[model samples]
Target: MRLGNVSLPVLASAVLCLGALISPAHAVPSQPWYLAAFDHVMRVLVNNEAPAVQMASGSAEQQNNVDPAYYSRVTKEAGTITLRGNVPSDGDLKVLQGVAAAIAPGASVVDRTRINPGVPNRDVWLAAMTFALRQMGKLNTGSASLRNAAITIEGVTNADDDFAVIQKKVREEAPKGLNLQVALKPHDVRPFVWLAQLQQGAVHLSGHVPSEQDKVIFGHAQVLFQNLTINSSMEVAKGEPKGWIEATKVSLEMLSLLYSGSVAISDKVVKIDGIYSSPAMVDLLKVYSKRLPEGFTLETSILEPVARAPAARAEDMSFAAHQARASYNP
Candidate 1:
């Protein structure tokens, strides 16, 4: 007999099997749509352990499979959108560039389509993208990857409320039997610093510093140099110097204004070795020297800032200023 123009026994059996498979799996008729990838991506969102803190860029690798399709969905929140490998027309990437552009007007969209055929887990491709998009929308940072129908979602977030929403949505959107991995880190907002050092013509700031103090130091430099290239090796850590915040600011200012010099501060010491910008700066430091925080001692040279003339033999402040220094024995 003719069944929808396909004709006979072959058509009947194919139709029967198709109906059976599609009932729970939602299999596609035109192409191989695997549920594994979709399930994997969905499961991670709702998974118990996948939550994070603050706002950091998330990443995912589309890999490891019996036969994996190289498709990835990345929502870089005001950064860029990246799509890689061969994605089905119905895949999440099909219209993702447009959608991403709409959401982040300046975000870049990169397409790297290298389709690998025979992937039966293609069905979940869109689900994976949608999941990533939702997570990114809430977390403002997230990534998704689908390989051999497996899904991975990752992000960094700070709000417990948002984490809860992500958890709920993940569970609700993800179907069962998914291979999902959720990687999220919690945000920590504590103040800390270790070493802040500036030297030569360039400012080299290393170690760690409290967020607030970091702002003052860097901010002051910005105002003075206008175009300063700071070699920053500092990080936000868990503690601060005995009285490091104010001392750090003064240290930075002294370095930025000097013709060429170095300033280094730690828990135990605040040492400066440089030529002062002017006699007034040296006086200024002497005036406020006592105002430096309690954690560190200040050790520096003193000299009148003389410029447009010559590079003096040594960077120490002028002898006249030194003789007048409060510590002078003579």
Candidate 2:
């Protein structure tokens, strides 16, 4: 065909046409499927409160069941994602399923790490945890009512074997009389002789029982611990924690909004204002506190509901069906 002043040579045209007919079509570019799948998995894990997600430093393995079309490539390792709270085995399995469904639907564990079986001296362990939790800002320091309070340890188990191993390891690592017990125990079953819950917040503290031996050992050592107590709390005048959404709008991001407000700390309530963010959005704030005497262990599992953005709604999926129909049509 001739257009303007240029004409296509018959031989060249024929060769071009033949090449188009014989060569395979290029594949469509897809968003990194594994990233989306992993993101979803992480969201579920975080929502369910996992302590950690251990991955190889740079493994490129992707869960099989997630839709490969949403991501371009998967990282070999997602890194270890630690959950702030304890995750039940059943809950963990559900998260695994959620990840599988996003990538390879039928994929099963290729390899796995067995749960560690060990128990530490409950009294000693609780004391250590109490000390650590207090340092982490989870427990409150003042409040006479909280003193001598009874606390129930939930979510985590105190295994016999684990305790034995810890004791053995401590003895082996430290000189004799160095592994001192710091946790206070009552004559009764309760391990804490002096523990108090915040009347209005998530913070709790064990009564201070000065041990001369513990003072001697810890006086000059540099040790760190995880603090898992609620630092403050806030009241919701309009929005609630359940209203948090994964969007930019203030209405959609209620948690972030609430966190920006003032935190009121008192005997009746301790309000904490803080930010919560993920890869998709930024500057999320939330107000949370634990209800205790109701439960213990410092880490309160506040059940909050989440909202979805209208733009991200799954109902707006008709275009995908139309595209599939057009592609499949004869």
What's the TM for model 1? 0.35
Per-residue lDDT of candidate 1, residues 102-193 (tens digit): 65567677776554544445556555655555555545466766665567777655433334345556556654555777665333323332
The sequence of per-residue lDDT tens digits that candidate 2 reaches over residues 1-330 is: 432454535434554565456424432235333334444554544465333333332234333322322111011112111112212234443453344333433333222312211211223323332322222121111100001112221111121123223333433432232233322211111221222122222332222222222232122111110222333111111111221110111211232222111212122222232222242323233222222222222221122223655343223223432332243211
lDDT of 1: 0.54
**Deviation in Å, model 2, residue 159 alpha carbon:** 32
Worst 10 residues of 2 by lDDT: 138-147
lDDT of each: 0.54, 0.25
Residue 121 in candidate 2, Cα distance off native in Å: 25
